[model samples]
Target: MSSWNSLWKWGSVALLAYVIVRGFSTPLQPGLVESSPSRLAPGKHALTLQAVGQPFAEPDAESADFSLILRSGKELVRTDITAITPHSVEADVIIPEAVPSPAMDAFLFTPEAGTLFLGNAFFVEDAAVGPLPADLRAEAPTEVAPDLGFSFPYQPTIVESIRNLLWHVPMWFAMFFVMGIGFVASLAQLRTGLVKWDLRAEAAVRTGLVFGILGLATGSLWARFTWGAWWVSDPQLNGALVTVLLYSGYRVLRAALGEDERVGRIAAVYNVFAFVMLVILLMVLPRYTESLHPGKDGNPGFNSYDLDNSLRAVFYPAVIGWGALCYWMYTLRLRMNRVEHHLLTR
Candidate 1:
């Protein structure tokens, strides 16, 4: 058992080191970053598109093979490429008088980079004529297999910020894991009135709160980049803040009671109630409301198609590594609490 325990402790450290190095170092997949003249009008329009991450097209590569497509509803409008550079492309797109939808999505199909998509990239307005005839519409390009390399997926607004997934998300998972432990310990304390269980419950709360605070900080930083704000009024964001504040009250309760004999039982009961509120606020309420946050409402979460195989390879280890580390902190705090109690009594 001792050998197994030591192996896990050291293994957690190794896994965390790997997550930090690999997660930060991985490159994002090639993607179209921006387009000049985001709005479009009917007629011949010259456009410039800038790209980031890996190069999509070779300098000497033929521009004829690369296709730029604008999708409006079921219609696919093709564009003529005038120039192709390593990191940008120039295209001339003809817009007809009428279209199915005003909002158009853009896709760049290349031999090397697969398909790069930007949703709602261009808007069409004031087209006086009807949709382009079927014969003029370009055929969809052949699908290219994505390059299997160690890289993060490129999402439009997310870009390199997607790397935060490894840090911000796993911290919350770790907090939940340790907080659950504390909840269970609180229950056991209430049942048996044991001082050890109370100590464990208190330590777990303290340690889990540390990760919870980290989670909030990392999430806010990610939001600043993606949402263009340090904080948003979104349901998931508010719920997480409320849950953390609720758990924080647990610490205040412990401090107020001081050395009272009833402190253990009262704290245990409060911890139980706080855990229940954590579930309601963080888990239940967010799902039912409209939220800009992923995994809520109709938004697809990391658990869905967003978390591809490459991300999963690093993400799962991060979850386990952070959980183990948080639990280790809980154990150390529990021991310290026990020592303090003994010294005070003697």
Candidate 2:
């Protein structure tokens, strides 16, 4: 039985690694490339295009060839062709170099000859380009391209980053979740004076703290790229720190009162208090107070839109994969505790 359990434990680790790698390596969504611009600069600008999709045979890099068109006042001033990678494209257009006496319209054309007209956008100059209208702003374009909805600015790299969402956030979530269970166990120990509950609580907290540290490390790396900060003083971030510290203090309590059975019960009571504080500080406080973190303030967090259909394919699997792995770890720790207790009693 023990050998079977050990094999399963090792298997969980392997499965987690596979999920992480595949989630990151796979492209966001594989299909034809659609042409879209992050923003359009008016007047004497270059309209560039590049390939973006599963690379066609030969050269492996030029995934697709693209066509571009710029029109002003019903006249097509320029038409060009270019190639791009799977994620980004640059197009150049010389918009007459001379300002239109009266403002003109801007437009783009794809190889399929579909027209994308930008309304009165020609007035936006390089020196004073106001924010693009919400319509023109860069987002996952709603209009599915003729080629089965694949479009320009498609980032396969983002799929890899999505793994971080599962590996990182869930670690903290599972940590807090397990620690909360431990906290309950601890309370039971104090109430009933049961050594068994104390042992369970100790093992859960130790395992939970390991996950907590992993969460912090991973979260810090992710934040650096996404938010341009390794750490922020936001409510959510601070709350997480507080929670970790609270558990660490429980360890201190155990050490400080070594050899005292009553001390274990007392420490268990404290752990319960800490868990309640963790919920209030991390969950409740962040919602009520303004936080720089997404999902707390007006800023958005991961959702269907953020994880897109393409990303969800791997992300959901990653969550399940990592959760399973963490559970495997928990079971090992529990078994070890049981063995140690048996020896001591024997």
Candidate 3:
């Protein structure tokens, strides 16, 4: 027990250090601004340019010369942007001088900051010119573009660094992992009819539910920023809620059956059933149903796409650290359960 405690202590410190270093090193997604003349009165039209992203908070002095290219049909018409604010700029288009009706493509760049192509499509049309042209017919690849130059949003404080990912998805993984242990322990109790295994199973489930609730709360907060909703009735979201409720019901069953020897076996059976349902409901159903959740329905999963390589370096460490911390909590609960069992018998 002493050795395990020592190992956990050292492991936690190392994991935390790793999460902090990587968080600072990681580059967040760059913000984008798209502006164009969707409709025009057949005269000079202006397309505005804007800088976005967390970095925009401290605008780069070198960004004063930001340029945007406006492509009319197959030709590049406008090549320079008039900087208004560090975050915004304007591009003037001489109507007929550029193109009769421009099927536009907007591109922006700074001296040190590399290029960014706005994904939002825009066009200009005139009564004289028919449908302009679909010169660029290919889909814009929706992936993180290489940032030739950028900086972190905030100074990488140790807590903020590790907490970014820890404060997001690690809780879910920790909850899932602990609950999975309970599922297996419950199965063992069912097979051997052992009270010891039942106690372990109960402890694991109880600890897991705590993390599960935290995961949901954290996820809801992150969702508000990224998905624009506190809670959306999406597939993955609904699936997670159902899984949490199912486990809550497991505890309810155990409580209602106070002092019954059969309670353990019955709850064990139900744990196995609930776990199976959890997999099906949270994992399978979300993929089949349309979801606004970042990870499902063609949206980027937490790390696969949305999180860049930089984020991954910190995120994976946060998972390990949080997992270690959760295990610590589980061990404490398991010991408490054993103590309670002995007292009840005595």
* Index of the highest-lDDT prediction: 1
**TM-score of candidate 1 to 2 decimals:** 0.91
**lDDT ranking, best first:** 1, 3, 2
Using lDDT as the measure, name the better of candidate 2 and candidate 3: 3
Please state the error at residue 79 of candidate 1 in Å.
2.3
Tens-place lDDT per residue, model 2, 62-162, is 43224334444334444333444343335555543333223444443333323344444344344331322232222212332534232222332232344
The count of residue-pair clashes in candidate 3 stands at: 0
lDDT of 1 by residue, 1-346 (tens): 9999889899999999999999888877889988888888888899888898876646445336678898988789988888888788889998887877888888888777788887888888886545666755989978988873878877877888887888998999999998999999999999999998999999999998999999999999999999999999988889889888988999999999998999999999999999998988888888888888877775436545355777888888998999899988988999999999899888
> Could you tell me which 10 consecutive residues in candidate 3 have the lowest summed lDDT?
153-162
Please report how far candidate 1 places residue 238 from its true position, in Å: 2.4
Residue ranges of candidate 2 with Cα displaced over 4 Å: 1-11, 29-43, 47-90, 94-123, 126-160, 298-301, 305-307, 342-346
1 against 3, candidate with superior lDDT: 1
Ordered list by TM-score, greatest first: 1, 3, 2
Window of ten residues with lowest summed lDDT in model 1: 298-307
- Cα lDDT computed for each candidate against the true fold: 0.86, 0.60, 0.68
Off by over 4 Å in 3: 13-29, 34-41, 54-65, 72-75, 97-103, 121-166, 298-307
